[model samples]
Target: MPRQPLVRPGRKLGAVALDVSSSHRAWLDPTRETYLASGRTLGELGDRIPLAKSKLSELLRGVGLYPRWEVIHRLAAELDMPSWPLHRLWRQAALDAGKAPEWIDRSTRASAATARRRPPLDHDGLRQLVEHDYRFYAQVFLCDDERDIAVQDTFAALWLRWDTALCSPDIRAFAWSILRATVMARATYRDGRPELEAAVFDTVALQTQISPSAGAARMTRLVELFRAISRLPVTQLDTMVLLHLCGFTAERASGLLGVPLAAVRADERRAMRHLESAVTLKPDTEGPIT
Candidate 1:
C-alpha cells in the first residue's frame, strides 16, 4: 500500500518522543502477561518500565482500559481487573460514597466504589492533562472548510507543554497572545483564512481590518490565499502563525519556542516554496476540493 502524506498541518514533529518508554516491551502486549500480573495500574507499570506517566495514561485511555469496568466480566478480561470478590467489594464501597444506586450492578459495585475513593490530581498533573488533552497553548490558522475539525483535533492531540513555571505574568501574556491569534483565526474561517494570513505577514496594519467587500468576495479571496499556501508542511505553518498571525518578533518567537532564529527564517523561505508548488498544482474542478 502507498503511504499517506503527513496530512496534519501545523503540528510540531518532535515535541514528545514516540519512544517515551525505556523498556521496549508493553505490559499490555501478549508476551507480557507475567509483568501485568504484578497487579499495578498502567501508571505503576510505567514507572518500572520507565515510560513517561502521561504517555502511559494516554495509551491506557486510548485502549478503553481506564475508569475500571462497571461490569465484572469486562473488568476481568478487558482490564485484567483483580479476580477476588471484585463485584461485592466495589459495590458496597460505592454505596458508602453515596453514588447513585442504579449506577452499579450488584456484581460490579465494588469496582465503582474503589474508583470513587481515588483522590484528585495534583496541581501539576491537572495542568499537564489540560495542556496535553486540549492543546492549551498551541495555535492554528485554517481556511474555511468542513474539514477544519481535523486540524483542531490534531493540535489538541500533540500538545504536551505543561510547565507550571509558565504561569508568570510575562509567560501568561505570551500564551494569551497566542490564544488570541487562534481565536481570531477561527472567527475568520468563514470569511477567508489565507488572505488574513497574508495580510498578517505583509501588512500588519491591514490584518485587524475586515475588508468592506461583500461576504462571498471576501471568502473567495481567502480561499485563493489558502490554496496558494497549501503545499507547505508543518514547519512553515508553525512559523507563519507565530511570526505573522500572532505578531511576534522573530527573536521572540524563536526564544519562546526554543528554536533557532535561522530555523524561523528558513521556515519563511520554505513557506514561499510551498506556495509556489501549490500554485503550479492546478485543481480539477470535477473533483472535490480538499
Candidate 2:
C-alpha cells in the first residue's frame, strides 16, 4: 500500500504554509503598512532600527528568519507601532519552525507605561541589568558579600551620574567601568591585611568521603595558598587574578586595573615569582606551609 503525504501538493495544511518564503509575505503585511505610513525609505528605517539594510529587505520580503526579541522591541519603539503585532508574528514564526520563542516574559503594558513615565533608566531596567551581570562581577571580586555591596554602591553612583553615562557611545561599557572601579577599590582597601581569617574550603566531609587522608591534606594546602595570595601586593594580585583566574585578556585587565599593558604583564610575572618564593613545598612534608 502506498502511504499518502501528510501535506498534498498545491494544498497547504493550514490557510498558509508556515514556510518563510510563502507565509512571511502575509505575516509581514501589517508591519510593512506601518513602515510605509511612516513615510520613510528602507534605509531611513534601518538607520532608526537595529537591523541592517540587507536584513530589513529580507524581512520585508517575507523571509522566514525572525529577529531577536530585543530587536523586535527596538523596532516597535522606533516605528511608533504597537509591539504585540510584531511579537505575535515572531511567536508564530517560531512555532512554524518547531522551536520555542526566545522572548523574555515581561509585561508589555508596564513597559509602555514606563516609557511614558521617564527615560529607559528606571528601577526595573537597572535591576534587570544588575541581576544579569551579578555572577560575572561576583567571579571578578571572588567574594559574594563584597560583590553585592559593590553592585549596590555602584548602581547608586551610576544613578547619580546617569546623565554622563547616557552620553557615552557604549552605555554597557560605561556601567561596567563604574562597577569594576568600585569593586577594585574595595579590594584595594582590604589589601596588606588578612582578608581570609579562617579556612574557606567548602564541605571538608564531602572531600573526605572521596579520599579521607588526601582530602584533609589538600584542604590545608588550599587554605595556605589562599593566605599567600592574600598577602601579595594589591597590584600584582589584581593583575594575576583578573588575567589568569578570571580569564580576561591582558588588554582588558589593563583597562580594568587602569594600568598600562606593560605594567599588567610585569605584575603578572612578579606575582608568579612572589607566590613561588613565598609558598615552599618540602619534599618530605605532606602539605604546604601554613
Best-fitting candidate, scored by lDDT: 2
- Tens-digit lDDT track of model 1 for 190-282: 334332343322333234444444366454555465545433454576566566545567786565545678988898777766665554433
How high is the CA lDDT of each candidate model? Answer: 0.39, 0.52
Backbone clash pairs for candidate 1 read 89-110, 90-109, 90-110, 90-111, 91-109, 91-110
The runs of at least 3 residues in candidate 2 whose Cα sits more than 4 Å from the true structure, single-residue gaps closed, are 1-146, 161-214, 281-290
Per residue, candidate 2 scores C-alpha lDDT tens digits across 1-290 of 21222322231212222454322332355455445445566566678775677677666655545545565566667666545444544444445555553343332332442232232446348557454344453444446675675666455445534545566664555666666556665553345453442323322222233243455665566556556766778677666555544456788766654567899888888877887787664442222221
Return the lDDT, model 2, position 57: 64
Off by over 4 Å in 1: 1-61, 64-206, 214-218, 276-290
* Candidate 1 TM-score, C-alpha based: 0.36
